[model samples]
Target: MVNGDPSRLAGQCAVVTGGSRGIGLAVARRLLADGAAVSLWARDQAVLEAASGQLAAGARVSCHCVDVSNPDEVSGAADQTRSRFGRVDILVNNAGILGPRAAVGDYPHEAFETVLAVNLTGTFNCCSAIVPEMVRNGYGRVVNVASVVGKDGNPFVSGYAASKAGQIALTKSLAKEVARSGVLVNAVTPSASETEIFGRLDDDRRQKLLANVPMGRFVEPGEIANLVAWLCSPECSFSTGAVFDISGGRASF
Candidate 1:
């Protein structure tokens, strides 16, 4: 349900990675409710199908199952989105993995690599493949999902934190690269949310994490989606290459 007008995004098309569930699904739902044709990209076809049904906007929503870490698959998906929708004006890079919690010296080597491959390199893959079209059109919005840990650094999840920090850096660099092209690139660093990602933390760690937040509550996906929807809209013009924190006052400086 759109809070204000349903035509806010009328005629636009958006691609949201990790759109099958969690914050990605919430953002897709908001974009569609605001009247943008949306393509949901994720690795699980079945989950994507379910998400489409949940959106209930019929042909206005499409689903493409692809791994964000794979450039070939991302290329094919971007091409297909253009073929089906004619353009992609907004892109939300929200796919990420939570690697096993451990000290930097003891973290699983493969797990760290996988996190970077999916969270950092994957964001680069999506932007590289899709932003060229935005450049050609002279209009676009890109919102990369980052994390507060990227800034302050959490104790146990070094890979996740490092990947998000890289994402923030990427947003700055890309925003500059495309600044003159009217393609605004920005990142959102959200605190722990009531999503699957938080489930990765054990009770003790989760409690400690919450203790760091002044709000003492997890963020809701819908709240993050609301911010993303605004960032995706033309109203967000004039802001680029910056980070918006939805961390419940946990971010300072």
Candidate 2:
């Protein structure tokens, strides 16, 4: 749903991590339609290039292949983006990985570590890498993609919940630290969405997962993207450290 307003983000540049698919890709598309130059960052070179190519000619879009979990790679991607677009006005920390789910006592330590590394640490790494430039420019909008599980802890998905909870904390602290510097930091927590992340779950597990939602359905990626685009707009200046929810009717709070 591209807004009729085209100048909302005109001349701005945005970086969307994990933009190859799902919510990230939808966000990138929305931002581009709103007149922002967008760079899509992801781990797969083929997917990244293919997505970039799909954008219509003359669209302000580009692609970078990098692992958000690695600080050096995140920094490299930031460098490449700046090299191409000059400055990034917005950063969407959307790259994430959901590790294995199991009861606390049965869950492997490595699984927990991997989830934390990707979901929590990966968000931190990308933000850290890009904030310097954002600060120097005296303008920035950072949206960390968290989860509702981060707010109300979920069973079996303890590792993911914990990691996203950490992300919420990071978003709040970072927002406070940079509020005076013209950088607004916020987070979006989406409940179970209809995305490929559920591939890790068996049919029974997936069915059970959906039953817990009050809406009894998974959220659409585009719905999450619409919220994110607004948060990244100039109208979002006064807000910082806010955690916006897009969990359908399930997250009434």
Candidate 3:
């Protein structure tokens, strides 16, 4: 009904972490529109409720208040989703943090740890919970929302960049592990996008990040969702452990 042609994800259940806002929210919306039952996972209960209310689907939506960095929390959330829908067919690891916009030498050590904890370890936790189920079912799609900085480091954001780079590596490693089990694991490395995450950046830092994109613009959340939706579909077969660069011409080599 949403797409009108065919629902590639009909009868599927997708779990999207950080689904309360930004790219995660957009991906949740698209997956719903494409007819997948969606379980939105976020750290904020109120915000997650508000996000779920934005979608008009009846009985096909759920939300989990969870911190992906916590293994127990991720496990409970994933179990709840499986309980709600019988199985989780997809996972979008979109939760992340934008660490302090300071040079590596000046970056706070605690901030660096938090960034990696959330961006990389959190992703691992989510995958740890959902991927085993996917492998059991012999079908799955995992999209790790990495960044262009992960591909090529950005000045003044070493923590953010390094964390995302770990996600890229994680994606590849997981893909190889589950390749023959009908599961596809891949990454979407996007450039600066118009999202609340950008608000975390100071103007000087934001401008420097944007200036590197040859397209002269920030990528839209919906645009990233579009690519993600397809990647989650059956048509996206034959590709795993690959980087889908949505960096607007910024990711060179």
TM-score of each: 0.97, 0.93, 0.96
Candidate 1 residue-wise lDDT, 1-253, digit = tens: 5463478899999999999999999999899888899999999999999999998989899899999999999999999999999999999999999898899899999999999999999999999999999999999999999999899898889999999999999999999999999999999999989787767667887798798889999898999999999999999999999999999999985
lDDT by residue (tens digit), candidate 2, 37-86? 99999989898877777655255888888887889988888888889988
Candidate 3 ranges with C-alpha deviation above 4 Å: 1-6, 200-206
Model 3: colliding residue pairs: none
Number of clashing residue pairs, candidate 3 = 0
Evaluation by lDDT, superior candidate among 1 and 3: 1
User: Candidate 1 overall Cα lDDT vs. reference?
Assistant: 0.94
**True-vs-predicted CA distance for residue 165, candidate 3, Å:** 0.5
Q: For residues 18-111, what per-residue lDDT tens digits would candidate 3 score against the true structure?
A: 9999999899888988889999999999998899888767689999999898999999988889899999999999999998889889999999
Which candidate's TM-score is highest?
1
Q: Which candidate has the highest lDDT of all?
A: 1
Range of the 10 consecutive residues with the lowest summed lDDT in candidate 1:
1-10
